[model samples]
Target: MDLNLRKAILSNISENDHKQLEATIVDAIQDGEEKMLPGLGVLFELIWEQSDDQDKQEMIKSLEQGVQQANTGS
Candidate 1:
C-alpha cells in the first residue's frame, strides 16, 4: 500500500488502463462488504486469459498449497 508500490503498478499502464482500473477499484471500494472482490475477480480473469499452461499449472499448485495451509489452521 506504499505510494512507491502504487506508482510502480501504474508505471506501465496507459491512461485508458489507469482510468478503467480506477473506476473498477472505486466501485469495489464503495460496495464495502464485498470490496476488493471485484478487483481480485479481474485479476483472476486476466491471469487465466493471458497465462500459458505452465503458468496456470504453477498458479494451481500455489492455490492448492494455500488451501492446505488454511485447512491446517495456519
Candidate 2:
C-alpha cells in the first residue's frame, strides 16, 4: 500500500483561507500528538517553498532558538 501523506494533507487544506489555515496550524500544535507531525511538515514544506532567502534564514534562526530552549528545559 502506498500512502501519500503530503499529497493528502495538502489536498485536504487546499481550499482553506488564511484564517482557516491559521486555525488548522494552531489546532494541530495545541493537540501535541505524534500523528500531527506529518501534517505540520507538509505545511512547513509549503512555507519553505514560498520563502525568500531572508525568510528561510529567519525561520532557521527561530527554530534554532526553539531547539535551544527545549534543550534547556525552559
Candidate 3:
C-alpha cells in the first residue's frame, strides 16, 4: 500500500481554525496512543520546516531538556 499520510493529514486539517488545531494536538497527546505518533511527527516536521534557525535551536534545547527530565524521572 502507498499512502501519503503527511499530505493527507495536512490536507484534512489545513482549513481548521487555531482552536481546532490546538484541540487536535492536545487530544492526541493526552490519548497517549502509539498510532498518533506519526501525526505528531508530521506536525513537528511542518513546524521544523517553517521555523527559523534560532527557533529551531530553541526547540532542540527544549527537547533535550525534556529528554533529560524524562530520563531522570523529574
Candidate lDDT (C-alpha), each: 0.67, 0.96, 0.94
Query: Mind giving the per-residue lDDT tens digits that candidate 1 earns over 1-74?
Result: 34563344435333547678767666666877564664456556666889999999999999999999989999
Q: Which regions of candidate 1 are displaced past 4 Å?
A: 1-33
Give candidate 2 misplaced runs (Cα > 4 Å). none
In candidate 2, how many clashes are counted? 0
Worst 10 residues of 3 by lDDT: 5-14
* Model 3 CA deviation exceeding 4 Å by range: none
> How far does residue 5 in candidate 3 sit from its true spot (Å)?
1.1
Point out the worst 10-residue segment of candidate 1 by lDDT. Answer: 5-14
**Cα lDDT tens digits for candidate 2, 1-74:** 99998899999999999999999999999999999999999999999999999999999999999999999999
Cα lDDT, model 1, residue 2: 44
Give the TM-score ranking, best first. Answer: 2, 3, 1
Q: Which ten residues in a row have the lowest lDDT in candidate 2?
A: 3-12
TM-score of each: 0.54, 0.97, 0.94
